[model samples]
Target: MRTRILLAVAAAATLTIAGCGKTPITPADSSAAIAGLGSEHVKVGMAYDIGGRGDKSFNDMAAAGLDRAKEELEIEATEATPEGGDDEGRLGALNKLIDSGHNPVIAVGFQYVNALTKVASEHPETTFAIIDDDSIKADNVVSLVFAEEQGSYLVGAAAALKSRSGVVGYIGGVEIPLLQKFEAGFAAGAKRVNPDVKVRTQYLSAPPDFSGFGDPDKAKKIATGMLADGADVIYAAAGGSGAGALQAVAAEKGATFIGVDSDQYQSADAQLQPVILTSMLKRVDNAVFQEIQAFIKGDRAGGTRRFDLKTDGVGYSTSNQALIKPLTPKLEQLRQQLYDGRIVAPTKP
Candidate 1:
């Protein structure tokens, strides 16, 4: 009882300070509601990857959805964070959340694949959602997967078209298959537009070393070196670390960058916005909100829910509106061509 009160209070405090996400609510009303939620609280537990909430990228987008659920679906939510990428620690955290009575829990990244599936099997009545990976199967598990490559392809095309040096670059946070899709699509899109264009792909770190997602300095160093190599435009698929790449672009004139996972042009530091040409929008918030609505409507089918370009789950951003206006038609044509199956994005570099 004491713990619940403390947690509820903390959450209320956070709500008061937070910008009210995609679904905002009045603090006084929400606080009273949170305190009284109890067994009736449409509770959702979220387990965050690596850098957790402050990434201002992937995790922040997920937080937006969860925040929306709090106000719109009247869900009481709690989040768990890992020290790094420790699978065991992640499992422990997830199980504890389940034991504490939060149902319809979500694991924010593929690192939780094995642990999430195992736990979901033990609690069949409770709905479970795993982001980024969909191979897991169980009556209670729901896969929240996205077509990231489709969005990457658009940004890749933009980078190629905007590059005066004819060489653009791509940087992946981790060398995992998920980030691989970003690298592959970026390279392919660039090649599609300018067959002679050079797309340089670099992975900051390998699996089990997810620090790549959080390390801005390392990304900055790599972006610097890549820029020195004559790459005028760079696309970064690294999480928070991608911000570092933007910093590098900021330092150089006429150099632009591509962002990932969120509308980072809007999310980034003001000075960095000019350098961020556009971002690949992976709508994690929309996915989270949709699932919560499904649960509210009693529609858990225990299957994969794909948020692809076809469903507006992903796309390119125009936060730098004036900069991209001239290229919108071309980009739109490519997007439609890809969506209509006229163009296919390759997933391997």
Candidate 2:
């Protein structure tokens, strides 16, 4: 089943807010969905992370994948976002979606790890997919994990190559293992090129307090400090807070910013686009589409499936020509080294 999961990323021609083209539907509104479409149609459910559908970063990428499934598979889809901060809220949402009879439910973010593990155990007959987590040891649970460090490594190199001050910065949403992966890759990639380059780092928050992912003000403050200290390039892996980081870089006379999860350059506001040097692309939408498509084909087998530099599951974006054009040759050389195992991005900082 894992072998069947390897497919190209879905090309999203449109990046509007989730449920943009259709009347909005949610898992709790199963009755409304049933009335509009018969039960004979397949129903899929997705539970979004902190900022939900319109985050324009992590969660939005997941929403795009679900949207594509709705269009191509004709599946009745319902989306839900948690309102509380604890695992209880996540557990309730998962239970509610499963009780609503939506099969192959997909949970976004590692925050859902414990909740999904408990729920998947109770509902052995149901299949579940989780992104960014691979600890669940159940046959009904499919762990769709990504090598985020691989992409971060590429953008880290880009930052070093373009840095005029010999210093770059990394602003993370949280000081967790996941965000650390980004910090590690970025620093490693930068030093790999310039050796003397300095990579400054800061986290907006720590574990059990995920608000950092959504707080742009704090991120901006941190980015501004880094820039003032001589960082001419900064990479943000701070989810919704990344907007604040980008804003800080834009205000700086010559600072450049790198984005994460999706093509932040493409998704960012028009006024903020030029400051974006490049983005580390993580194809969560592609993973979601493959999971749903597999379910529709009656393939319910579940296990850990990984997407990384070798599989094109993760890479750097090329949207900002002014910053990326001259550096392409060097970046590509490092990319090939990563793909061929000649170079490995450190997973820890």
Candidate 3:
């Protein structure tokens, strides 16, 4: 879908009226005001990550953001999914969006960082926004990164509290700094709850392969091993690999699992639903929408934009009301402490 709207970036100048006062207008403020202006029909484009759409995770959350933008901003938007799992394929799709005249293109995942950086630099007139990755340094590009550790910490505490075996586990897609943030926070949260709790960590691959994220069978195997080792709650930071953990939890007796990115309560089958404790909510949708809105309003802030728990950009899911009701108040307290600077979460692994 495409919508066309006229948008102009006003130049800075001094306006003088006869027998009146003179007013000075700065270029930055004028550009911001112009970007803020939205018409009945605006065109936007979105590029999905490797997982594509309907993974019920990161890509899905990003799609939701695009959908919301369509409804609220009356934007005519279309999304392009990569044909194959290569950076070239991803860049090709993004190029198609730009060549087709889609302004303000938004890349859904960190995997698009290099592609976006290259494209944004090539097309300085086009605006771009990226989530989860920050490889791009162009002024026309906006990078949205999150503090996954803060949300993971709270969920880790919940996992430790609910674990009967006193052994918790974390499974990650890769060992990169981003995934490491999730692992470290979860481990810290679990340890904070129970000093004696054993937190086991595992990654699908050591060097990090994008394909490993969607391997459910691999996730199931890792999760089953953790369960066999007396792990009661396993937190999955693996993208598609998380599905395997859910499957293992469903098959295993008396084992629980925590999901990442989005709430997996409804994503799982009826039997597995009960076993899903909660998800570490990374509010990617909010971040995406806010950035797009800013771009439309000419208020684009070019640089790395951090989304933390304090900003309500990242958090633990409360969608599973029955499972999370008892823990909400305490979690809120911790969230407040983090926002008030009373609590500090470690960023490094």
Please list the Cα RMSD from the true structure of every candidate, rounded to 1 decimal place. 7.8, 6.8, 10.3
What local lDDT does model 2 show for residue 61? Answer: 84
Please provide TM-scores, in order, for all candidate models, with all chains considered together. 0.87, 0.88, 0.87
Q: Let me know the TM-score candidate 1 reaches against the reference structure.
A: 0.87
lDDT of 3 at 345: 74
Error of 3 at 299 (Å): 1.8
Q: Score residue 238 of candidate 3 by CA lDDT.
A: 90
The sequence of per-residue lDDT tens digits that candidate 3 reaches over residues 1-349 is 1111211212212222100001123344434433435563557888887767898999887887677666555578878998877789889889989998888898888778778878988898888888887766667887788888888888988888888899999999977888999998898878877899999999887654666687889989999999999998999999888999889987888887899887778677776788888888786776766666666666655677776654455677665667667766776666667667787777665
Ranking by lDDT: 2, 1, 3
**What is the TM-score of candidate 2?**
0.88
lDDT per residue for candidate 1 within 43-162, as digits (tens), equals 789888877897889999999889877875577899988764687888887987899998889889888988887897788889888889888877778888877888888888889889
Top-lDDT structure, candidate number: 2
- Per-candidate clashes come to 0, 0, 5
The true-structure Cα RMSD of candidate 3 reads 10.3
List ranges where model 2 is wrong by over 4 Å. Answer: 1-40
Instruction: Point out the worst 10-residue segment of candidate 1 by lDDT.
Output: 1-10
After the best TM-score superposition of candidate 1, give how far the Cα of residue 217 lies from its true spot, in angstroms: 1.5
- Clashing pairs in model 1? none
